[model samples]
Target: MVTRALIESVLTRARERSRLLTDSVDDGDLVAQHSPLMSPLVWDLAHIGNQEELWLVRDVGGREPVRVDIDALYDAFEHPRSTRPQLPLMDPAQARAYVRTVREKVWDVLDGHPLAGSPLAENGFAFGMIAQHEQQHDETMLATHQLRSGDAVLVAPETPDLGGTPEIDTEVVVPGGEFVMGTSVEPWALDNERPAHAVDVPSFGIDTFPVTNERYLAFMDDGGYERRELWSERGWSHRREAELAAPQFWEWDGKSWWRRRFGTMEPVRLREPVVHVSYFEAEAFARWAGKRLPTESEWEKAARWDPRSGRSRRYPWGDEDPDDTRANLGQRHLGPAVAGAYPAGASGLGVHQLIGDVWEWTSSDFLPYPGFSAFPYREYSDVFFGGDYKVLRGGSFGTDAVACRGTFRNWDHPIRRQIFSGFRCARDVQGEQA
Candidate 1:
């Protein structure tokens, strides 16, 4: 049940996450675009405020807006990120003041209301929506930090070695059955993940852990990128256009490979999940390995379907929320843990890292559920549904738990290599062994 205390906690978390991004950088850093692919950090900050105002104050509480002049400046689709710096964006002080004002009024409304009846207020969904929104932008800002040229402004203790020998039984055989593909009970799940429906998945063998750097390096060593036979037509064209030899941020220095991470260069961690890889890269690797990517339904069945109980759990680890030992999440560490890490977080069928580490891309297009209905707004997921986009499941180190769950769905263009993505290969099961 949604309570006042829960609302306050969510608001505090959203505010804290925004502060982590805003406080670490200078005023100039906030307005300047770190990369043409992303909005200026300041735009995200104000846009956080703008969305909170739109959903919480104006839409939910029915209050007058504190400022309307800044709305267009924060409208994400209206201006491209490359062109954002040229716009008359708010100075740092103004942006802070604006977010502060919005937060104060939004809190007043929350305190005044019973937070029920209306769909937006029901189950504290609007507040949850805003919290998830801010956390998402915070992750976006962190990506901007990675794309930036300066020294690392953020730091965290390195993730521990969750060491274990890679299993020869590297894949799990998910039994063929009818499993619920989406959700109807999870209150905070977004519109696209709604109206749970059944899907009949034939038996498949999915990798126990996400594909690792050691494994992907082998593919590269075998000339996987150069050989046009391994890639799809669109992917091969992209590979030639971008000259992609390995995952983004990786380079071969004659003898060995080194990767740039948060303004520092280090030898790649062979055991960690191969991250920053695009869907095309994953697909090519799968083809090179003589396997195939899992369909969206196949992926979900492996992660959530609990054959014993005959129900889908909220996570691979069960219905409990993610914690430090359970999964690497909430920017606790900047990168993925080793592939064999987090054994306790594995699915019922022993599929590992199904919750966090990196977003696992599937061989499926972003599409609507059977009873797809646009809720609150269409821009959230509706506009992007088509064959042009690919679906990425699970979450990453930067993903906040408020924003991530087993039913959670993330999509991006197949060519996107920047925002902490990875994948594991799956193939049709023969008998019971993978």
Candidate 2:
């Protein structure tokens, strides 16, 4: 499955998405932030390219490539994320051309070699890691574009009037039982999804849909930020020290409201899922609404239900490819569809839109399950858990549909708000008695 063509496909898509950001000479300091959260477009392009060469070629060869300046050109973690790199900057045209050259060279070298012979060489693992890493950066670039330029696209559904919230009187109940919690083996699975094992989950109720912009607005109107009682200790601290307000793109236009999306402006959609909220924000909203966020296991169980079969399916919509009619992924609609647009993607218990729309926040921290072990790349899972990271479920508007499998696990800081993130509420088996 690891082919040069596959690698090239990933690289080409990454480059195309990166180009979506329009950086001008007058934009001043092309570098945005220095954190690992996102990379400056200039730095992102070269860093990713160099990483491909470093792991696939240089590391495999036990030597650096001949002409590239590995140290001076590609070292990004050393400098702050906000500081624009002083290295030779390239205009979009020149930068893109160089990227193509590097990509071709790397793919050629990889294709010609018999890397599968040595598992420890980590050629296969390195290739997948870098490919997925670039894809993630692409998503981050989309978010950063929305934040900086006020121009991120939010799309309406292809077929409108698909019904908003259904008339369900109560949350869907998931019976308690032993369930496999993590991933086993697949064509490509991140290290965090590994060491799959059984866990006993108590019965519980989960919201049929993710929290919507209309619902979150109610929290804001009730002075959700001003009231510290509804926030967790850490959430309260983050709110105070950071002076957090509304979600990243939201703007109060006096009598009404608007939001900046994909380099364009639009009136906020009240019924749509609230995008661009951090874990802290989602948790606060849940608390204000007198509900709680679900754990990742609970999310997985709820998403496996198939109403038609009364049994679990591998994905929310059964074991099938995500067609355009089912979910709002792959940049097809340009951005998000209304939360209820994908009824077909619902879990067995009638949980709608669990796979793709916006990634839902979970109450759990990012952690390894029992019997955890490191993958070829040690930095993948172990390095991220110790930080203040939280887990997210489903997939976002910009997430690659191929990468958003049901068992796939994603995580980020609770304070980050630039991504197309959202959350749904859940209750304990005892109905808040727990």
Candidate 3:
């Protein structure tokens, strides 16, 4: 059970992260649209506040609306990211003040409302939901910073070096069978990850670490982009249309490749997990390496299933929440840690970096599990369930612990590369039933 103190702590931590991310940039940067794929930082700032007010202050506490006039402006379904800039958004100062006011009101609700007796409030689920929502937006804002073209506006310490990279095996075998695939008990879990269900998976060999830049470079060096046979029909078509020769923000000088990260250009760190690649790119690379992207079930089994116990873990490292030692998460580092950097966080099958680094793309489409039901709303998960989007497991460096878990699901179009994404290869075990 969650305590009021824990809820307060998480809410405070989420707000602190939101403030740091937004304050890192100037007011001008906050209002500017860094990319059409993402909203202006100011819009996200106000939207975070608006959501808290709607869910907690009013809905949970039976309080009056806070700035009801601006509700439509911040309603995400009402406006797409491309058109958010055209709306009458609160400026940086006003956005700050607005969120502050909303937070004060939310605290009042938290103090008065019982933590049980309702689905939304049981175990402080609504408060946890709000915290997770804000953290998710904080990650979105970090992506916007990555898309912005300007001098470096954010600073973070480098991930701790594990002395030197460990000499770990390249891959591990998951002797998969039936494993629980989703959660019914995680209080803050969203609608899509509900009703934990059993999945029978065939044994498979999966990469021990996320595919590194060095490995991806080998694929590119072998004319991976020029070869169409390695790619699917639609993937090839999109590749040709976009002319995606490398991961996003990558440039080749006369001699070597360098990538721009949040305004600073640096040589590609070959040891780090390759980021900003689309599903098509990950797929083509997997084929080039004589393997395939793991199915969603395969990925989860590798990350969460422990054969000795015949059960699933809440995280690769166990039920405990993430910290700096476990994963390179919460934007503590500007980029992924070197591959094989987190041996302590390895799963039961010795899969390293499965919880955090870059979001690993899977071969499965985004679909609801059996016994799926939309709770509270439909737009959160219902509208996006289909083949139009591919499922991505795990979380990126920008993802926060509140918003990521063993069963947490993320998805995007096959052609999207701007988000922090990567992949690992898998192959069916020889002579084994899959």
Candidate 4:
């Protein structure tokens, strides 16, 4: 399955995503600090190259590093995001030239190497890893652009009006049963998602779509933010300390809501899944609505459940890879499509937008599965396994196809509201059926 074509396709995706990250902004914007939480765009530009060089060239191909002298400069672990700006980052052109130089050699490596000898190269995992890494940075860089001011530097055709969207809130019933929770077959699946295991989950009812902006706005309108009882002690304190009136980038103009998007201030899109909300916010909203965030297993079963086959799917819609018509991914459009937009992409139990829209927050704290082992490096997923972070399932609009899968797991600090995170509620059925 790890054909040369597949390897080249992954490389092309990485190149395309990198171009998208670097081409939109001027050199000044590349180094400018958009947020202390994010690295400079130029930093990401070179870091992507650095990762490729370390893995594809030095590690896999058994070649000397093209830029060993600058390796430490781009080591993400060495420089925290807050201090990255102060480091001696290469200029955008230098970074671009360096990556291009690295990539040219990487292609040569891909052309002649034996991809079967190692796990990293087997199944084109290393190429896919590099592609996924670059695409992830592309998402981060898009976040930077969203955080930056002045004027809208990015543009995408508005999300389609997928007309027959479900209205009047309803939940679908997922019968209690045993199901495969993660994956062992997916070639590019990350380590945390490894060693697929069986999970016995009770029957539950889950929202047909992600919690929409309109529904969340209703929570805010009804004093969801003011009521401490609805929030956890930590959540309430964080909300109070930060004074989160609404999701990040939102402003209630007293009359109605107005918010900033890529740089344009406009009314919030009502039907899209609420994005940039913290775990606390999601939990608070769930409390106000008298529901709960689904456990990681519950979320996966809902999205991947298949009655006929009694198995988990690779995506909400069965196993064929994502296409633009099927899912809104690969930064094809910046903002999420309207909720209930992709009927074809819904799961068998009628869950919509489960694949690409927003990273749905789950109730579970991130922990490793049974027989879990880190491959290549521990820094990727091993470092974040704890209560300090909450898991988010599904992928966002900015997520690329190569990086996302039904079992793909994303995690972040509970107080973070800057990333594209959202949630859908799940409730136990009154008379559960096993």
Candidate 1 on 1-434: residue-level lDDT in tens? Answer: 66889778877987887898889989878888888999889888989999999999998889998887778888887888789889998888988999999999998999888778898888888988998889889888888888887777888889766647766238888888799989988887899998899998888888888899999999999999899999999999999998898899998899999988888888999888999999999999999988899998888888888878989999987888888777888888889998767878888888888888899999999999999888878989899888599999999988888888888899999999889999999987767842
Q: How do these models rank on lDDT, best leading?
A: 3, 4, 1, 2
Candidate 2: tens digits of C-alpha lDDT, residues 226-288: 899889999999999988888877788897788777567678887788888888888888888
Candidate 4, 1-434: lDDT as tens digits: 66889878877976887787678889888999989999999999999999999999999888988889888999988889999999988999899999999999898998898777888888778888888888888888888888887877787888876746578377888999899988998988889998889999989989988999999889988999999999999999999999988999998788988888888998998888899999999999998989999999999998898877898899888988888777888888888888878888988787888888898899899999999999879999898887599999888998988889898988989998778888899887879653
- Residue-level lDDT of model 3, residues 1-434, one tens digit each, is 68889899989999998999899889999999988999999999999999999999988888999899999999999998999999989899999999999999998888887898888888888899899999989988888999998789889988776626765337888885789999999888998999899999888999988999999999999999999999999999999999989999999998999999999999999899899999999999999999999999999999999877989999998888888788888888889989878877889888899988899999999999999999778988998998599999999999988889999999999998888999999998976632
What is candidate 2's local distance difference test score?
0.71
In candidate 3, list every pair of residues with a backbone clash.
none
- The TM-score measured for candidate 2 stands at 0.85
Kindly give the stretch of ten consecutive residues in candidate 1 with the minimal lDDT sum: 160-169
Candidate 2 stretches greater than 4 Å from native:
1-8, 21-38, 59-68, 71-76, 84-94, 110-115, 120-126, 150-170, 305-314, 431-434
Computed on alpha carbons, the lDDT of every model, listed in order, comes to 0.87, 0.71, 0.90, 0.88
TM-score of each: 0.97, 0.85, 0.98, 0.98
Model 3, TM vs. native: 0.98
What is the Cα root-mean-square deviation between model 2 and the actual structure?
Answer: 3.9
